[model samples]
Structures are given as structure tokens and as C-alpha cells.
Target: MSIESPRTAIVGLGITEMGKVFGRSAVDFAVEAITSAVADAGLDLSEVDGLYVNPGIKNDTDMRLQSTLGMRDTRVLATVQGFGSSAGQMVQYASMAIEAGMADVVVCVYADAPLQEGKRAGAAYPGQARAMVGVGSLPFAAGLKAAPERYAVAARRHMHAYGTTSEQLGAVAVAAREWAVMNPHAQMREPMTLEDHQSSRMIADPLRLLDCCLVSNGAVAVVVTSAERAATLRQPPVHVWGWGQAHPGYVNRRGSEFGLVTGAAQSGPAALKMAGVSVDEIDVREIYDCFTYTTLVTLEDYGFCAKGEGGEFVASGAIAPGGSHPTNTGGGELSSYYMWGMTPLSEAIIQARGQAGERQVDRHDLVMVSGNGGVLDFHSTLILSAHPKGR
Candidate 1:
């Protein structure tokens, strides 16, 4: 059965300080974010009846947060697992709970204390030898070993197929850093150029150090409630018009079709269709940017440009501030704090609420936010608006 459209709105947003070391546990960050969000929503912690969390690098669970935060009425507690792509799904769970009358207000949260955890924070996949054997004759053995290696193969393939240049990939990194300079919360605020991106150490072939997302320690939380309830809150409601999720299966199983496309091809259109809007109506785009190629391919998959034409689309600076399409205004994961996809979702909400300060877009009425999980295996898309539907 098809799930009903989300009728909820994000009435509050909160984020803890992001950096290399917070000297605090993940639960501490989660509590701080939830408290801030509750206050921002003009509600007491006791009013929260639902909780959604994606504890990446954190050992905490939903019950722990509910107890620590004093959410005595929390009726719906869920933890979604999609690796980095779990943030958007958290919102989906909250919306579903609210729609079903299981809860009145829901808080979606994510927290990570990677820096404080030291070497344990940077754990690599174990049993690579056995994994390679499982792949059998598939050539993806090496790429499957790590994220960078997988994306590098995709970048190389895109270059060979469409003549996409390394400079084009560098343009994506440069544009993100450009936005970063304006974002105080961005971890890497220093101005970066295409030359700087090209000169950075190569992590995996075409993917450079600057092209990858940051290793950050932080927490983000957003309060979700029905539109009717949000109107009485202190903050403006960023209405959730539409949302869609898709999985393209595993890369190793998909074979040749694996890296050639992303799940956004399905999720993006589904969200727009559900919202009764087209791509051109979107005023802001907050797509996941785990890597430069991730952004490039996602743009193409979202129908922002033709297939294999993402390089030219971004190279034209269309995604920069004041451009035709303002994307990842908070510098995205590339320059912003990498709390999975929470960084982009938070930026989208801020822009939709007209609270983006200097980086705010001229037209902030509509926004399209996308998230990627696994090795381009899972995707989620959301369409948000400044005003609720029919308002």
C-alpha cells in the first residue's frame, strides 16, 4: 500500500557546535540539540511524544534519549539505519507517526562524537578478504573495500563516458567552499579555489582530499508536528510537502549499472510529483555532497540537467549563491559539518524559514533536499515549502 503524503511541518531546528573535538559524549550532544529544538519550538520537553534518531558512531538508543531528555510521554521511539542517508528517513518516521496520531510532536536527531573517540571513530571495514571472495568474479572487489575507492571508479567512468574533466569535479569543491566562507558553522571556512582542489592529496584516483566530506563531531535535531499545531508555535513552519525514498540495490549486485546512476532518478521525481510541483518550481536545492561526483551525478538524476551534463551545469556556477539554483547554502557536507545528511536538511529548513541571514536566497518559498546512503545504493528526497499547502 502507498503511504500517505506527509502533513507535518518542521517547527524547530537545533545544532550543537561542530569541530574536531567536542570533548563530550554523543548523548550529551543529542541532549543539547533536543533541548535547543524544544525551546526553539516554544515547547517543554514533556510535550515531546515521539523520537527518531540515527545514532552514527554513537552507542545510544531511542530509550536512552527519551529518559535523559525527560520525554515522559514519548509514545513512538524509532532508530533508522541507512548509514549516512538515515537522517531524511528519520523525518519520514516522525511524519508517519504524527499522521497516524501516534504522537503529537516528534524530534528527529542525529549525533556523532567521532573526534573524541579517537582511533575507534575511524574504524575501517574488517574481513575485506572474505568480502572479496563473496563478490566472486565481479570487478568491484577493490571499490567495495572503501567509499573513496568506489566513488573514484564512478568518477573515472563518468570522465571516460562523457569527457567529464577533473577540473569540472574541482569546480564542485570550489563552489562548496565558496559557500563555506559565509557559513560560521562550517568546519572548513577558508576560501578554496579550483586550483586548491586539484592540488590536494588524492585519496582515491580522481577524488581528492578536498573533494571528500569532513570528519566531524556534532549533533542536529528538528522538531516536527502537524501544520495545524505548528501555526501556534514561535517559529515559522517549514511544511513538508512531499517525500520519497528509493534503493537501487547493492553496487556489487547491480554489476555494470551500479555507479552509472543514482537512486535520486526515482526519488526526486517521486517527491516532486507528490508535491504537485515540478523541478523548476524549486527555489533551493540541498543535495548530499559526500563527494564531488556525488553532487554531479545527483544533479543529473534529479533532472536538473541532462544525463552526463552535470559537469557543465555546475561548472557554470549555477549552484553557487545568487546563481539560478542556490544549493547547499550552508556549504553542504563538503565544507559544512558532516553529520551525515543532517547538514543539508538543516540548511534547507533555515532557508525555508527566511532565517539564513547573509546566505539566504531571494526566493526561499520552495526547496528540494536530497540524501544519499551506502554506496549510492539508497536515496531519499523531500520537498519543503515556506507556507503550508492551501495557505
Candidate 2:
């Protein structure tokens, strides 16, 4: 479906105090974000007919939140989960529902409270060995009971195949840190350099502590409605031009295409095709940076650069603030908050609405947002614009 006027738009956005804030459950953040987003959209809870909720590491669910928020009589209500990909999937489903007349207004939210007072961030995600009790996975048998180790292997495979270097991955980290300094809410805002990235202690072989995303406690939510309905409401509408998803299951070893290629290849093309735009048309990009390598490989997968050339593409500081490719303008999950895909989704909206403050790009016409889940297994892409457009 394509039209000159966008059929659906995001009318409201709410983000709680992300990062290490303590003493609040994921449910608390969910209600806070949902209510605030509704208010931002100039709507009442009673008028909202649809709701989408995705839990985080803490496992807060839609059922718990609906009751906590006193939401009832909704036409569409369900749990959306594809790990990190849920954020984009929720918007895609909400848009489809609104177009089909299933519901008028839908709110999608994700919240997690994994940080406890005095506990280290690593404690939030314990060893995966317990989770692999019943299974005899190759990774588990090899004592790869943690995420960083698994990802390190993937990074190693990419490096071995294409001769990617640490400094190249460090470039992505430096760029994200550069963007973080501009965002007030980012967790790690200190100025960083390739040297700093190299100096940071290694979590697993090629991956350093700086390369991984920060663990945080917070929530991010958005309200979606028809463009016509949005124009009659509060804040300017962020048009939903197009969206797409791909889930390429990961194999534990280097024998498969797991580390080299990701879902961005298919999903990016699909989303851009639906949005009626090209790579060059995107003025800003908010990519999920669960890890620095994730950002680099994803850039290559999205056609921003050729496969196996992500290292050279990012080493030029192009993805930084004063460069050709503006990416992760809100600091991204690497240095910014990590609320799954919401980190990128929230920033995408902020940029699309021209509310990024110092980090705002002059050209805010088109923004590309990506979501990745698992070990680069699940992926989803969204193309957004400030002006209404056909899908």
C-alpha cells in the first residue's frame, strides 16, 4: 500500500530516565512511559483502543501492565516479542492494524529493570550455562556460557575471513562515544578515541568492555495513529513510511554465514523499497549497537558499504557527527541507554521530529532505523520521515 499521504504516524513518544536509576520495577516504567506518551499525543487512556508491550530481561508482560495501567476494552492487545526486534515489529503490526480498522490508536512499550542497587551490571545477565541445562548445544559444551564469548567468536570469524582489525571496530566505538557526548541521557559520555577503545579491558578476545552495550533500567514507548488523526492532535506526526523484518537463524560456528552476513541485507532493501526511497535519501541512521561489531557489519549489510569493507567504511569517522554518514545520533545502545530496540527507535523519532538538540542533523528528512535480536539472528528495519508519505 502506497499513498501520497501517510496512512499511519507516530504521534507521541515517552522515555523514562534511562541508565542506572534504581528502585523502580519494569512495570512502573511501563505505566509511566505509556501514560506520558498518551498525554503527549493529547489522548486519554480511555480513547486508546490498542496496546502492544514487550518485556526485557526482567520479563514484564502486557497482562501485568494492562492491569497496572487500568487499560480495558481495547480492540487490539497482545505481547510483541522477537527479542530486540519487537520494537519495530510492534510498530509494523500497529500500523497494519490501524490501516485495517482493527484499532484507531495503539501504544507500544518496552520496559526493563535489570539493575539492582549495588549489583554489577554483569549480574543482570547471569551465565547461560543454567539456560542450557537441558540442551547439548555446541557453544554450551565448549563452555561458551556467556554472550560476550559467543559474540567474540563471531567477530573473530569475520576478522579471519576479511582481515578486519581491532582499530576498525574501535572506530565504531569512537564514533558512538562521540555521539554520546552530545546526548544528555547517554551513560558513557566521556570523549573516547581509537586508543581509548584499544586500551579498554577485553571482555572476550576481539571484544572489549567498551564494545558492548551498557545495561540499564528504564522504558521507552510510542503512540501510533492514522496520519489524519495525528494532524488533528498535539505534536507533529512522524510518518511511518515503511517497515520490514528478517530472521536468519544463527549457527554456533564459523562454517555458516552467521558472522559475515546479517538480515539487514534483505530487510533494508525491503523497507527502502516500501518507503520509495534509496540509501542516499536517508539523512540519518539509528542502528542497534548491541556491540560495535554489530554496528559495522550491519552497515555493510545495509549497503552503506560493501560486505567485508565495514572496517574501512567506519575508520574514516564518516558515521560521526561532522562526517558524511550520521548514525546513532542519540548515542545508540553502545554509549546510550539499552532498552532493546527502543534505543534506536526512540532516537529515530527524535531525529524525525527535529528534537535531537545539539545532536540534531540539519537534514532530517529521512531516517533509517534497524533492530537486531539474538546473535544477529532476528532483524527488522523501518524507514521514517517527518512529512506524510505513501507506503
Candidate 3:
């Protein structure tokens, strides 16, 4: 039998030491993360009947991981990828498998070691200009091959159409840094300000250095099981109430609302509807922050505020630590380790479990986690709660 909504529980979370560490490949980190998650859930390695891996940009981790882990039998195993949206998608997939009796215990993991020896973090993803050709050549001609450049086009458009300013974007970075200062796991915990954001060198017009996310080497993993089984687990169960994904294809043509809006517009409401809750019911938000502009647009699309008012909304400190909306309490990708969507997904689990320590919000009965991949191309949303559905 199939359940209309799977109430899978995230019982364990494994996060390896994040940032600048060397000599370990993505596979090595994956081994540690998965094993830690298994142990965290009070389960033996043998109990993991499914494995879902989202490899880093290096693409070094894959299905063979089952062999390395010595999992002689697994009902489900695969490498899932949707750029940054992979984490939420993995949990959603694992939940379905559990509800269908396809697997018992599953571990969804993401690991990357992009920072190389002797190379600055910036070199991890070089801004090497793509070959100038076709519609993509527009940014290529301007030497904007890197993500910041391509994303800048979208940020600029949002600015022009809605009067978004650089200061508004800086507000996002500054707020992330503020939250990071209170987080022990954050990579850049030093205090930051809007001035720091403004003075930082401009990576792309309208996108400053601080406006971007940090590049790091790390891995994060979460364990999923049926809500019934979670009762016997070691940690408090973070119930997965609902999830939704949107892979809206983009086109490089006039009249296309590419960057101005994102898949979050579709996925957020769908997930909320499935959870039988409204956005106002969400107590915490763990939005993927690949860039500052990403957070702003997602909030707008998620209906956190009126469309085109994200700049003013964020500038008012609505998402800051003490703000009405507690967002990215683990510092997010800006100040925290960048584990792709896992950064936000992991934090959501922490908050839902009420284990965030100093950064934990007082009201975390309901949480919303968002993942956006490929410059607003793919989007996924997961609704988690301290209590199970229909409670």
C-alpha cells in the first residue's frame, strides 16, 4: 500500500569537519558521514538498506560507495543530482522508498572537496570564460564565465525592475555573518557588517565578493526511516511532513521570467499545501544561499514578503537572528560551510530537533527547507516539524 504523504523521520545527522582541511577525498568524507549517521541513529551499518548519494562538483562519490561501505545488500542505491536541489530531493526520494516498503533505513549524503592544495578557495571554481557561442556568449564576451557573473545578470535584472540595490544584497551577507558568529560550525565566524559587504571587491557588477557564498571542503549526511521506527532511534525524530520539487526549464529569450522568479514559487506552495500548513506556520526557514541574491528572490517567491520587496524586507532585519523570521541559523553558505543544499537541509534538521543550542529558535514546531539549483533552474522544498502530521 502507498501512503498519500510519507511521514519519514530524520533521526540522525552527520557533518564532518568543514572547510580547508586537506588530504581527504569526497569518498573518504562520505565514509565518515554515513558511518557517523548510522551510529548517530543507534543503528549498525548493516541496518542501512538504502544509500542515496549526491556527489560534489568533483563527482568522485557514487554507487560504488556501497561496496566500500561493505553493504552487501541494499534495496535502494543511486547517485542523485539536481545541482543544489539534490539534498531535499534525496530526502523526498528516500521517504517515498520507506513508505513503499522499498527500504528500511536510508542515508542521504553530500560531500565535496573542492578546495585544492596550494590553491586559494577562489581558484576552486575558476572564472574561466566559456567559449563565446550562441546566447550564452553574451556573458562570455564580458568574461563572466563563473557563477557569480552569470548570476549577476539575474541580480541586475531584479535590481532594475524592482529597484533592488547593492546595499540590499549586502544586508543578506551581513545577516548571514551575524548568524554565523553564533554558530560554532560556521567557517567565517568573525563579525561582519554592511560596510564590510560594500567594501569587498566586486566579483561581478551588482554582486560583490561578500555577496557570494563561501567555497569549502566538507560533507553532511542525514538518516531517514519510517516515523514508526524513529520512536526507537537515539535522537529526536525530525518528521518529514511534506516535500515538493520543480524543475522548470529556462530559456534565453525575451519575456521569459528566468531569474526574476524561481522554482521556489511553485515548489514552496506545493510543499506547504501538502503539509496542510501555511507559510506563516513555518517557524524556521533554511533556504539555500548560493548567493545573497538567491536568498532575496527565494523569500519573495516563497511569499515571505510581497514580490519585489525582498530588498526592503531583508534590510528591515526580518530574517536576522533576533528578527521575526529566523533564517539560516547555522550561518548559511555565506558564512557557514558550503555543502550545497545540505548546508540548509542539515540546519533544518537541527532546528526541528531543537538541538541547535545557542542559535536555536524558541518556536521551531514547524520548519521549511528550500533548495535551488542551477541558477533558479531546479527547486525543491521540504516541510519538517517537531510533531508528526495530523498531530
Please list the C-alpha lDDT of all candidates, in the order they appear: 0.84, 0.88, 0.90
Where does candidate 3 stray beyond 4 Å? 1-3, 127-142
Task: lDDT for model 2, please.
Answer: 0.88
> In model 1, what is the error at residue 13, expressed in angstroms?
0.5
* Candidate 1 local Cα displacement, residue 141, angstroms: 7.6
Each model's TM-score, in the order given? 0.93, 0.96, 0.96
**Colliding residue pairs in candidate 3:** none
Model 2, residue 328: displacement in angstroms? Answer: 0.3
Error of 2 at 280 (Å): 1.4
Candidate 2, which segments miss by more than 4 Å at Cα?
A: 1-6, 127-135, 251-255
Could you give candidate 3's per-residue lDDT for residues 1-391 as a string of tens digits? 5355677899989999999989999999999999998899899999899999999787889888999999977999999988899999999999999988899999999999999989988788776535666885776676766788889999999999999999999999998998899888899999999999999998888899999999989899999999999988899999998888997888879888977888999999999988888999899999999999999999999999999999999999999989999898899999998999999999998898998898889999999999988778999999999888864
For model 1, give the 10-residue run with minimal summed lDDT.
Answer: 120-129
**Model with the higher TM-score, candidate 2 or 3:** 3
Tens-place lDDT digits, model 1, residues 1-391:
3554567899989999996765787888889899999899998888999998888655454546877876675699877787767877888778888888899999999887767544532342221334345547365554456577877887888888888888898888888888888888889888888889899989889888888887677799999999899999999999998888889885445355666678999999998988888998999999899898999999899999999899999999999876888888889999988888788899999999998888888899999998898778889998999988862
Higher-ranked by lDDT: 1 or 2:
2
Question: Residue 261, candidate 2: how far off, in angstroms?
Answer: 0.3
**Top candidate, metric TM-score:** 3
